[model samples]
Structures are given as structure tokens and as C-alpha cells.
Target chain A: MNYPSKLIEQAVLEISKLPGIGKKTALRLALHLLKQNEQTVEGLTGALSRLKKETRYCERCHNLSDGPLCTVCASPSRQENVICVVAEVPDLIAIENTGQYRGTYHVLGGILSPMHGIGPEELQVASLLERVKSAGEEMEIIFALPSTMDGDTTSFYLMKLLKPFGVNISTVARGIPIGGELEYTDEVTLGRSILARVKYDFGG
Target chain B: MNYPSKLIEQAVLEISKLPGIGKKTALRLALHLLKQNEQTVEGLTGALSRLKKETRYCERCHNLSDGPLCTVCASPSRQENVICVVAEVPDLIAIENTGQYRGTYHVLGGILSPMHGIGPEELQVASLLERVKSAGEEMEIIFALPSTMDGDTTSFYLMKLLKPFGVNISTVARGIPIGGELEYTDEVTLGRSILARVKYDFGG
Candidate 1:
């Protein structure tokens, strides 16, 4: 599209570089910003600049952090011995929002994807191994990655490496989701759910 | 959602302030930006800041421009006596993209909307009248605004004000879109199309 102004065109080009935002949406966003006050635009730009320049990764888990450690890693109430291994910081946030797990997290940055040139070395495998090696007592490593082939491969590789450390390794359950209809569930997940079924308990 | 970093949270909050962008999409965009290099992030911020601070409106048409006149208004080939009146700069751009019209444009900035506290005083109505009055010869004023209640009200109000000036005032045609099926067409549009039917001509 022929933009009326060069500044607007440049802004639209830069905004369209983001994922899921096309040229039309980018134009809309730029126009909306133009209508806003200077202070509002400054606020957005300031936040984005600070987010990129100042944010760091947690030294222990590789999750995004403002300092050396993330809030989860710094919190004393979280169980340090149980580390939930996730593929990225967003996954860690998703699990944290559940508020069901008291364990700390280990963000691998990415899963093992040979197609994408991502191997075990591309992830935070060395740091995770060092973390487990330095532990004084037995630790638990839970695989909370996606249920994709890449996720399975990453988990298997990590399991083999952690076996020598004598740490207990487990994976999050895979089955029909709560409130999901059985008929609509994929065959593989349904079959796995059946095989992994536990005895029903009536006692509260 | 509980963000792992305060910077990420702040960025998300600011980004979500944009129209149509919710917290989840904001977080996704923030993470996407975090993954980009520093130079890429700088490019976006620079473009946005320049778009907000350096951009100006055309002196004649009120369209977005980097200088005193927008490209359309500054062009020598466009018909000076024929002005297409639009509600906003985007509408002007849309009409320009059609390549069918060779007339200049006058942007009203917004339509009449009493509910939103917008009126003739809030629009560029006075400037439009000044331009029409200053014209040395007969001129044509075409309304290309949306076919909404506010658009109709604004056009009606402008018509009454421009009638005394003796300019040939007109509006864009309202009809079913090309390639639209009559079976599913809305009743009002179909009825309007029937009433405003043009003469069929085979001698092209």
C-alpha cells in the first residue's frame, strides 16, 4: 500500500516484522499511535526499550529475569529439589499460572528439533546437568514440554544423561484434558489415557 | 498471567493498551521482541518515535504528510476543482488506491457522532467551506464517507451548508459489491441497488 507519509510507512514496515501482524494490522496500529498523545507513545516505546535492554535470563533456569535470578528461582517457598523442565519462559509462566506445582523451573530455551538445527547443545543442557551434579541430595526432574516428537526426543536425551546422577525423572501426564469429551480426543491420547488409568477412589 | 520478569510485564501492559491487542497477544509480541536483536528493536522504536513526532498533516487536505502538502494535494495532474470528501486519512488512501478517481481529497478528520461528543466543530468543516468559497470557478464535492448513520448525518449537514456556494455536490454510489450474490445480499442494500439502477449500455 502507498502510505501518505514516509514515517508512517517505516513504522508500518517495522511493526509488520512481528509475528502474526500483517501490513494492514501494522498500518492500523501506527495510525492508532498517531492519534494518541506523545506521552502514551513514549510510555510504550520506553517499556519496549527497557524490556529489551535490561531484561536478563535467570542464571539457574534460563527463564527471563530482571536480575541474576527470576522470581521463581529467588523465592524460598518454591521447592528447589523439584525442577519442572519446560521448553521456554512462556511455558514456565503457563505452569506457574496453574499454581498447582511448588517446584522451581528449568527453561531449556527450545526443544530438540533437528529440522530447525536445534540439538541438545542448543539448549541449556549443560547448565541443567551441572545443576543436578551439584545437588547434595536426590532431586526430581519433571518433563513439562509439549507432547510433540521434539519434546519426546528432548526428554529421552535428558533422561539418559540424568540417569547416572541417580535423580528421579518423570513426565507430566498425557491424556484427555479435563472437561474434554472422549469421542473428540485423538486416538493416541485416548489409548494412552486408557493404558495409564488409575483405580477410581470414592473416598474424599 | 504471571510474567517471569517485571520488564516483560510492563511491556505487555503497554502493548495491550493498543486496540484489538489483549494481554496474551501482548505477551507474545513482547517475547517475540525479546528474541530479536538490539538493532531490530531499535529500528521499531525509532520508526514509531519519528512517526509520532515528525509526521504532519497536509495544509490543504489535512491528510498525513511529512511536509506542508500531502502527495495527492501537491500533485499537478489531479483535478483541483473536484474534491473527494472523506472521513479520515485511511479513507483517502483507500480511494487513492482504487486509481479510478483523479480528484483531490478533503479529510474531515471524523464523522458527526453526538454520542462520542464529536460535532462539526470537532471536524475540518470550516476549512472545507473556506476551500469551496475560495474556488474561482465551478467545483464538484463528492462525499465518499461510510454509509453509516454518522456518515449520513455529517453529509446532510455539509450539503445544507454547501448548497449556497453553488458547487455540484454528490456522494459515492451505494450498491451491492461486485461479485456479491443477490441471494444472500442484505435487503436494504438490494433495495437501494434496485432504486439506483443505472442504464445498461453495450456500445462501449
Candidate 2:
């Protein structure tokens, strides 16, 4: 980066590793930190360090957690009989924040991307199927995936497997404002999308 | 911020306090972390937590340092007779990276902004004056301040106080490209700017 000091360069490199932080933004961030008081700078650094140490992943749903299971998974009020399957933890959080959908969740970790070498085996689909089977006839699994091509592929694969178990299989409706991320959509749209869910029709 | 969780809201508030980061960027950052692997997310949080805890201000120059003096101040190779005065630690770093100059530095911490109630008393100008007065009668002072209004005012005030001391005073010459940042300038341009420096003279 042609930075003046090793420390500054190191800081810039670390910051640049962050998502969406380009070289310019990294330099700006490092410079911003340098401009602040020592306490402020140190506070941020300390928080970053602790984030690595204190946070954990929920073993049950693969979502971020403070302890063994995530807050959502552990909550008794949530409807465990209904599991909303999503591609990532952020989507789960977004869905939870809308105050709609009191169902529990299963984070798929990622969608099926054959080109990226991410197939059903690479994702948490097997675990989700197992969850459906283990949770017995009472459980219902809703595929709340993005309507992207890979997302649709993942849903089809999951639907084919879950059909034998006979647990209810549904998907959030497709008319969700083209190219919009459910995570960024407001509560009203997201709630409507959930309310307008459609049945999965596997080829007879 | 009306976040779904208390910890997420607190963390977002803290992260957004960094310069130029707003609510949207904070949310994006939080989501990015949520998407990353547990170890990466934890590492970032841990670093934030320890950022302030493990770092301290250099006793002499007030630059961020793990020890008493910053790396630059601690280096014995720098010219002891010439002290470059700058507004922030990042500015000092920018100069050091050129490798063309071997002078030490004094950070003013910030500029004088009376409109925002930032006066000379708020800056380290007094400390700088003290450092210069105690160093030596023959010591030279270089005003490597920015071309901003505040930088001009600061350098002007310092010149008056420093002139009576009879030390050779100078400033880095301009024409490096109007309004361009010293940090972003190529080494050749920065070197040329430093080489073209002229003696500081208040209009007699």
C-alpha cells in the first residue's frame, strides 16, 4: 500500500480484509482511527479482539450465538414445529426483527452453487432433512430462500428429499419485488411475502 | 437504533461512532460479520475489544504506541535537530514512509477550530512549544501542516511563538498539486515537495 509505517500498513491490511472495504476505505479507516483519542482507538481494537474470543456458533442451527445454542433456538416461545430454512444467519435475523413469523430457523450456511463447487453436500441441507425427520410428523419446513437460480435449485433438492417424510413443505412466494433482498426489505413487504407463500409441487 | 437485540444495537452504536460510518454502513458491517465464519467474526470482535486495551499513547509525541514512545520517536537514526510538526499521527506516518526525510515529529493532536470551540488550548501546541524550547537553540522547526484553513492558522501562530526563539524555521513548499493530500502523493512528488521547502517568514 506504500504506507509510511509497518503498523499503519498492518492496520490498513486488516481493515481491507473486511467485506466491502476497499483500499481507499481501509486507508480512510486507519487514518480516522489515528485521528481519534487513544482511548477511542483502543476501545475499538479491544472490541474487535473480544469479538473473536467471546462469540460462538449455535450448534443446532449454525447461527451466531453467545453460547451453545442461539437465542432464537433456545427460546421456548418460538414455534419449533415450524422451521424457516434460509441461506444465511443475517436473513434469519432480518426475519426475526419483523415481529412476524414466530417459527424457529435452520441456517443453510449457503445456497447450492454448482459453479462455485457448492452443492447440496456442501450446504447444511442434509442436516435440515435430518432435523425434519427427527422433529417427527409435527414439524413443518418452509424454504425461505432467495429466488436466485441457485436458491431455487437448493429448494427443489430439499423438497425432493423432504417429501418422503411428509412434513409440510412450503416456500415464501416469488412475487417479492424483483432483485430485492428479503434482508433489506421492510417489515410490511417481508410479512406479505410470508403470508403469500405457495405450495411446493414436485413432479408427480 | 431500534435493533432487534440489545447487544446488536450496542455494538452498532459503538461501531457507528467511528468517523464517516453511519447507520446503514454499521448495519452492513454487522451483517457482513454475521455472514462470515465464527472464527473470523470472533476475531474481529476480539480485535475491537482489545484495540484500546492493549494500545497506549506515546508519552512524548502522543502517537499510538504499545510502549512509552512510538516507533518513530524511539528510532535513534532520525535527525535530532529538526522536528517536523503535524496535526495528527497519520500525517507523521505519511512523512516517515517517504524515507527521504530523517527528522522526528511532534503531533498537535488536532487543529484549532474556534467555531467548534476547538482552540489552541485544546491542541498540543503548548506542548510542542515546550518541546522546541527545551531541545536546543540551534534546533530547526519544519511546519509540515496541511493547506487547510486550520493548518494555516496553526502554523501562523506557531511561527510567531517560534520566531522569538531564534531557531531556523521552514515549511514544506507547496505546488505539489493544489489541494492534494500528502498521504496520497507519490513518493517522487512528496520528495520534491519536501526538497522545495522554503524558510518561514511572517510578512515584515
Candidate 3:
């Protein structure tokens, strides 16, 4: 669509480059920015620019960090022996939000996606292998990656590599969601949940 | 949710301040930006800053503009005697895209909303009156505002104020949309369409 101002057109074009945002939404956002105070717009731009310029990845876990190590990797209370393997930082954050897991995380950056030209080398596989090789015999590795084929492939490849290290390898359970109904649950997940069902424990 | 990096948290906070963007979506967007190259992030921030700093409103019509006059107001082909009053720049652009109208526009900035503390004094009502007073008797004012209560109130208020100018006043027709079916159409709109039906012309 034709824009009244060249500046607004340029702003909308740049905004629409982001994922899930279209030209119409970008235009609406730009117009909204125009209505806001100068300080508000400046604050938004400042925060985004600082995030890009100052943020770094944890050298150990590959999670976003302000310094060499992320808060998870730096925390002493976290169980360093148990590393939860995730496809990305957001996945790590999701697991952290549950508050049940106290283990440290190893962010893979992405799963193995051959279609997208993302192989084992494209991710943090080498760093993960280095960590596993140097860790103690009691170290446990938990795969918290997606249930997709790419995620499974990445997990299998890593498991095979880590076999020689003699560390315990496990994966998060796949089942119906907490509030999901039986009839609506997909067949594959339902079947997997039945096959992996645990013993009924009487104590809470 | 706890973020791995403080910079990511700040970026998410700023991003979620935008319309329709929640914390989860903001985190996703922030993570996506982190994955992008530094130049892409800089380009977006630059465009947004420039849009806010450089853009201006047309003095005559209050439409967004790079200079004193907008493209529509500056165009010689546009009819100066006819004015299409709209609620906002987006509305004007929507009507312009149709290519059915050749008249200039008067942007009200917003409709009359007492709940939002927006009234005649907050909009471009004074400027519209000034323009109407100076124009000739043949000048016509058309209301192309929304069909909502606020839009109607603004149009009615303006119409009453412009009555003494002896200019012709009218509003855009309200009817069923081009591809709309009568069965699914709302009762009020369908009833209004039947009441406002025009003579069917065979020759196109």
C-alpha cells in the first residue's frame, strides 16, 4: 500500500522483516509509535540496540548472557552434574519456569535440520561433547528437545557420541498435557504415554 | 518468566509494550533478533528512529507528510472544492487505494470519544471549519468516517457546525460488502442495505 510519508514506509518495511509481523501490522505499529511520546520510542529503540550490542552467549551452555556465562551456568545452587539438553535458550527458559528442575542446561542453539542446512556442526554439539568428556561418572544428561524428527535425530546423535563417556542418558517424558482430554489427544502421543506409563505411587 | 540475560528481559519488556504483543511473543521476537546479524538489528532501529524524528503532518489536512503538504493535498489533479473527511491517515489511505474518489481529505486525527477524553477541541475540527469558511459555496464536504457511535457523533457535530457555510454535506453509503452473502450478514446491515438500495443499471 502507498504510504503518506517515506519515513513511515521505511519504518513499516523494516518492521515487517520480523517474523509473524506483516506489512499491515507494521504500519499499525509505526502509526502507534508516531502517537507515543518521544521518550517511549527512544526507550524501545535503546533497549533493542543495547540487547543486540551488549548481549553474548554463554561459553559453556550457549544460552544468551551478559557475560561469559549465563545465570544458570554461573549459579552455584544449580546441579552441574545433571545437564538438561535443549534446542534453544527459550526451551531452557521454559523448563526453568517449571521450578521443578534444578539442573544446569546445555542449549544446542538448534536441532539437526538437514533441510535448513543445520547439521551437528551448526549447533553446539562440539562444546557439549567436551563438557560430557570432562564431567564425572555420576553426570546425567537429559534431552529436553522438541518431539520433532530433527530433535530426535540430534538427541540420538549426541547419545551415540556420549555412550563412550559412560554417563547416564535420559529424555523427558512425552504424554498428554496437564489439562488435555483423552479423546482429543493425538494417537501417537496417546500410544507413547501408555507404553511409558509409570507405577501408581500411593504416597504424595 | 526468568530470562537468561538482563538485556533480553529489557528488550522483551520494551517489545511487549507495543499493541497486541504479549510477553511470550516479545521473548520470541527478542530471541529471533538475537539470532539475526548486527546490521539487521541496527537497520530496524535506525528506520524507527528516523520515522519518529523526520515525519510530520500536513498543515492543511493533518495527514502524515514528509513536508508541509501531503502528496494528496499537494497533487494538482485532486479536486480542491471537495473534501472527504476521515478519522485517521489509515482510513484516508484505504479510500485512496479504491481509486474511486478524486477529492482531497481532512484527517480528524481521531473520532469523538468522550470516554477517551477526545472531543472537537482535541481533533482538527477548528482547522476544518477554517477551511470550510474560506471555500466557495460550491464546496462539498463528505463524511467518510466509521459507522460507529463515535464516528457518527463527530460527523453530526461537524455537520451542524458546517450548516451555516451553505456547503453540501453527505456521507458515504452503508450497505453489505461486495462479496458478502445476505444469509450471513448481520440484521442491521442487511436492513440498511435494503432500505438504501439503488436502481439497478444494466449498462456497466
Predictions in order: lDDT: 0.94, 0.75, 0.93
Top candidate by lDDT? 1
Report the lDDT tens digits of candidate 3 across residue range A67-125.
99999889999899999999988898889899999989998888999999998888899
Q: Which digits, one per residue and each the tens of the lDDT, describe model 1 over residues A73-105?
A: 999999899999999888888899999999999
Candidate 3 at B9: error in angstroms?
0.8
Q: What are the runs in model 2 whose C-alpha is more than 4 Å off?
A: A1-13, A22-82, A98-104, A114-122, A134-141, A147-149, A167-170, A173-204, B1-10, B23-81, B98-102, B134-140, B167-204
What's model 3's overall lDDT?
0.93
Q: How many pairs of residues collide in each model?
A: 0, 33, 0
lDDT of 2 by residue, A63-167 (tens): 777778888888899888899999986688778777889888898988999799998887787778778778845878899998778988989988888889878
TM-score of each: 0.96, 0.67, 0.95
Q: What is the iRMS for every candidate structure? A: 0.7, 4.7, 0.7
Put down candidate 3 lDDT per residue, B1-204, tens digits, no spaces. Answer: 899889999999999999999999999999999889999999999999988888899999999998999999999999999999999999998998898999999999999999999988999999999999888658899999999889889999999999998899999999998898889999999999999889988997
Q: Please identify which of the two predictions, 1 or 2, would achieve the higher TM-score against the true structure.
A: 1
lDDT of 1 by residue, B1-204 (tens): 899888999999999999999999999999999989999999999999999999999999999998899999899999999999999888987888888999999999999999999989999999999999999989999999989999999999999999999999999999999999998899999999999999989896
Per-residue lDDT of model 2, residues B1-204, tens digit only:
334344455556767887778976777686566556776765554444344335567777776776788776788987877888888876776787677888778888888777788888988888777887788548889989987788888889889988988888898877567788878998876886788776798997
Candidate 3 segments exceeding 4 Å error: A201-204, B199-204
Local lDDT at A46 for model 3 = 97
